[model samples]
Target: MSDTRNAPHVDMLRSPLGRVRGLGSAHRGAVTWWGHMLTSISLVPLTLWFIWSMVGLVGASREEVALWLTRPVPLALMLLLLVATFYHMKHGLETVVEDYVHAAAPKFALLLAIKGISILLGLLCIISVLRLGL
Candidate 1:
């Protein structure tokens, strides 16, 4: 029921790809994606090892568990697990915040909080393990 004679050309509203090439490119997309994939892949083996270790220690007394942790390999692996877990967690939360939170200030604040909390918790966990193991 509307007149089309005076309408603007459809092509006028469409941008040519050449003209818009790098306008909105965030250069870090590939790095972030790679980080996500690597973390997820690393988590599989680390998580499995943690589960297997815990299962093996199910009936162990506190001292037995501590003694097992005191071994160099166990202590190192535990540290690696904690690091990978926290880094993965932080990366995931940052992605969520970047995707969902559009506002600049709030997005930045959320990212800062996520990083701060993740580091704090990771350090606490590492310290706990060290205390128990060493």
Candidate 2:
């Protein structure tokens, strides 16, 4: 341990090149922050509409449910929610895997698996919603 008064403290907000002594990659914090903001903004209305629609279906009959789901706008919205939800899940899970998984191969494998499963589940849910509409 060196003298605390003279030692420099790490600044997390600074670019890697500014803080680091040697080689550093270009900063991507802003890009990641924008991506997160976009996802969050898109999810807000999608989640609200999905919950509201489900509430409306609570006591609906089979035909009523089918008709409601089959409408073009609702079907499209449902599909959009399915895709967006899965994408968000994939992004979150990737962050978790990257943070916790230490080994290279396992991290890569887990990330790939999460992405694959998210896509598959998203597609399945979309198909089910479409089928209900039909």
Off by over 4 Å in 2: 1-33, 59-62
lDDT of each: 0.85, 0.81
Q: What digit string (tens of lDDT, one per residue) describes model 1 on residues 1-134? A: 89988997575322465335522244343456667788789889889999999999988999998899899988999998999899889999998998899999999999999999999999999998999998
Evaluated at residue 123, the lDDT of candidate 1 is 98
Quote the RMSD, in angstroms, for model 2: 6.8
Model 1, which residues run further than 4 Å from truth?
A: 1-24, 27-29, 59-61
> Backbone clashes in each candidate structure, one number apiece?
0, 0
Candidate 2 residue-wise lDDT, 1-134, digit = tens: 76888788765756666556433343334554456667788889999998999999898898897898889999888887787788788888887897799999999899899989998998889888888987
